[model samples]
Target: MSETEQNGEVTAQLVDGSTPATPEALFEKLDALDIPHRTVEHPPLYTVEESRSLRGELPGGHTKNLFLRNKKGGMWLVTCLEDRAIDLKDLGERLGGYRLSFGRPERLMQYLGVIPGAVTPFSVLNDHQDAVQMVLDSALLNHDPLNFHPLDNARTTAISPKNLLKFLEAVGHYPQVISLD
Candidate 1:
């Protein structure tokens, strides 16, 4: 592992001068994992409110993914339902007092290979080093088909909660589930 990896730089090179996985490449990986997913291409959505416009056309539970880091430079990707309320301070307390803050856009791209609007658990596909910790809300499991951007905000992909976990494990990002109750 590189020093960057030790410091939680997930977007580092993939072995030897290789590039991060593209959205299409990520889809292929999911396919290889035998993870069933349905995707819809539409206008780019940068916020939950923007995604609301497609509620009628896009069915299933949508998600909001956060790329965060702690004072110690530990990285975390938290995914929960789009409408779920989040109290960062409280969450930080629950997660071992991380002093959490949103990761910088450059680091996000470098690690997850995605911009602010495109952050998703799928971005882990780019983190070949497993440098980022994954945090998932248990409530999201109640939804049969969970929706997320496939490393791009221009499209949304739906997959079963079980399959999501399976895919994450396959990619070496086993989630740490939390209940928001």
Candidate 2:
């Protein structure tokens, strides 16, 4: 938090002081792995439209994360470009998650440890039980720096696609990369 380093990741607590999934903890993990990242704080964003409005032209692959559960209670965290259209039925067939449905808020917190608007692969940090599978869109990997909420919607973090995979593997949640057509 210096003059020249404005807009950098500060490793701070979430507004609610939530445990096991705070931005502070995520930042610490990123730092420990020597994964270089840049983060900027802005007005809390709950939608793609709001992100574009407030985050104006941030260079990178802007992402939207989905928390889905299959009929068998299996869960997945899907990260794709904000503009990517997802057909849940097709996705379920492809991922072998037939009859997929959005996880309830309570289940979302139970698994990924984040609220609806705050869902992101980074929340897998709190997936201590490794109960959720991570699915990454192949198109997202083409972008040099991919952007995601750092366990909260008020801030966004940027990292290289390679580093993202590295961080995920380090955390024991290696993602299944697929093209979501």
Candidate 3:
């Protein structure tokens, strides 16, 4: 790991450029962007129910991310409140695409640089091609602090709602926030 201070904030870079940012590196980027955040380490969580068991009293808008693709091959990363009910059929129409289905694990890895259990908005950083469209539920933005996996399922990070948008924009993803009700 290499650390550098730029514009008054410290950032960490991976020694190997070929690998995606580790949880620590992701925290460094958040710090460099001046995006306030808190991270908690835990055993890997693959589902919302599993995460809820470990999150305990952490207060924030916990999220469940879906890696999806349209029939035409367009991809999307949809992040929403963990309890929100998402109808893939309706979402496909709203997104103006053919029926959407869960993206394959290989495609998810190719686009987001994370495996099935680690889907996250933070993974946008690894999308050097900017090929994945980001869809955020408006309700998640309504929370003061939004929580997500930091490109890894073994931990969760919370950032202010506004700062979440800032981080996404910085990573070349302009999120589309809509009502997921």
Candidate 4:
């Protein structure tokens, strides 16, 4: 079946269907959950600087997602304001010991099914093993809407902050809200 048709059928099944396996499939999951969102297709963004140029066109609280792992292999997906300063040393303490480092590209793909620039909470849908812990910056949560790449840096998806939590829960991820300030 065509991608569009598959997505349509997936939406028809709602939350009863399996997790989305592709970026397009992710949208289908969102639709199935009745969560409102806006997607803007744009040039691929690898860094915050590249994405900043499109800020005017996209309205919402933008996020930068980090995939981190400790020496013990405890993995975390941290999402915060695009401009927020994250002190890995401090965050490591909060997350419980052993200094955290960015998970390798291959590891990211294995866990989140996304490339480096595409890391987002939405990627958790691809984590069928439920191995990654999710963290949301309390500062970013104050915003009504949140924006992140939808498993692909070429597109940005915006959804209300409350809906983000709902989406995370639907995907079996329990997000920890912490102050990254």
Candidate 5:
């Protein structure tokens, strides 16, 4: 089946006139965890620079999320400041043992149930196998309210730093806060 025939239509139907499982379910989980957050919607654009441009429209700190994979196909989630210049190689080395690369779209969909241009920590909610591990840039964790996608490109979610830690804990993953610099 083509991408459009599969999730595209379903996602469009769910997102066009209504919110879908990706973001809605994530929010439900957040609510269950008693984690408070605000959602912001934007045009579907796939770059950190574009996402950063929406910062003026919001009152939250912006973050960039990377869905990466080790050479062994182990998935990793890296959430950091939107402005930081992150070299994947340097990051892989610092993170230790295994060259990092962009994860395959198939693996992304299979593991996180998220498509390209919509990677986020919220996607981790779909990772029932606990295959994806999370890493938070220390600088970003220091910020008060950080914004990220709620598993969709059309919306952004802002949550307190404490709430973020809480959400991660709720998702059953203990994120490692590291200094990206």
Candidate 6:
């Protein structure tokens, strides 16, 4: 196994090249909840499509996540499949917001401790204030197993959809799951 793998940095523990992450802290939290997961590390990609193309034939339905905020700077989590086309305006309305836009990179780092490409539900671990409200695309919940960034951008982790819920529970955040359609 590679050094990164040995350190749990490669696979499921994938991290951002720019962020100095505490994998031990993350794993410790996961361990506390006994959440089952596996990781794969790689060079970082600028887009979710790029990440998907690079991660061919993975075991689960990989999701593209978006961290956004309204005019009020209220944080929101948007998880969806690669193929889905989201009308952000409609999404904003469905989310009960008058307006929505991409949140600032600074806020991303502040609340989630993640930069843009590194946004993942695992980032919730860093949001100690519970400042971010999660909104999971319902379609994603149907995926038996799901893939997501493990608090960083350079790696991806696959875990059961149910286990994803367990992980969220472990974080003490209950996501408001909704359907895009």
Candidate 4: stretches off by over 4 Å: 1-20
State the C-alpha lDDT per candidate: 0.85, 0.85, 0.85, 0.84, 0.77, 0.75
Better candidate by TM-score, 3 or 6: 3
Per-model TM-score on C-alpha atoms:
0.88, 0.88, 0.88, 0.87, 0.85, 0.84
lDDT of candidate 2 vs native? 0.85
State which candidate, 2 or 6, has the greater lDDT: 2
Off by over 4 Å in 1: 1-17
Per-residue lDDT tens digits of candidate 4, residues 1-181?
1112454562211122343367789999999999999988898998888889865667779889999999888899999998998999999999886599999886777677777888899989977878899999998878867888988899999999989999999999989999998
Better of 2 and 5 by TM-score: 2
List runs of model 2 lying over 4 Å from the truth. Answer: 1-18
Clashes of each: 2, 0, 0, 0, 0, 6
Clashing pairs in model 1? 11-110, 11-111
Q: lDDT tens digits, residues 47-149, model 6?
A: 8779867887777687777888887768887888867788889988888854888887767776777667878888887767778888788888788678877
Over the stretch 86-115, how does candidate 2's per-residue lDDT look in tens digits?
A: 999999999974878998877777666677
- Between candidates 1 and 6, name the one with more favorable TM-score: 1
Arrange candidates by lDDT, descending. Answer: 3, 2, 1, 4, 5, 6
In candidate 6 the C-alpha lDDT for residue 74 amounts to 82
RMSD of each: 5.4, 7.8, 7.0, 6.3, 4.7, 7.0
Error of 3 at 138 (Å): 0.4
**Candidate 3 TM-score to native:** 0.88
Model 2 lowest lDDT segment of ten: 10-19
Query: Over the stretch 70-104, how does candidate 3's per-residue lDDT look in tens digits?
Result: 87889999999999888999999999846999998
Q: Is candidate 3 or candidate 6 better by lDDT?
A: 3
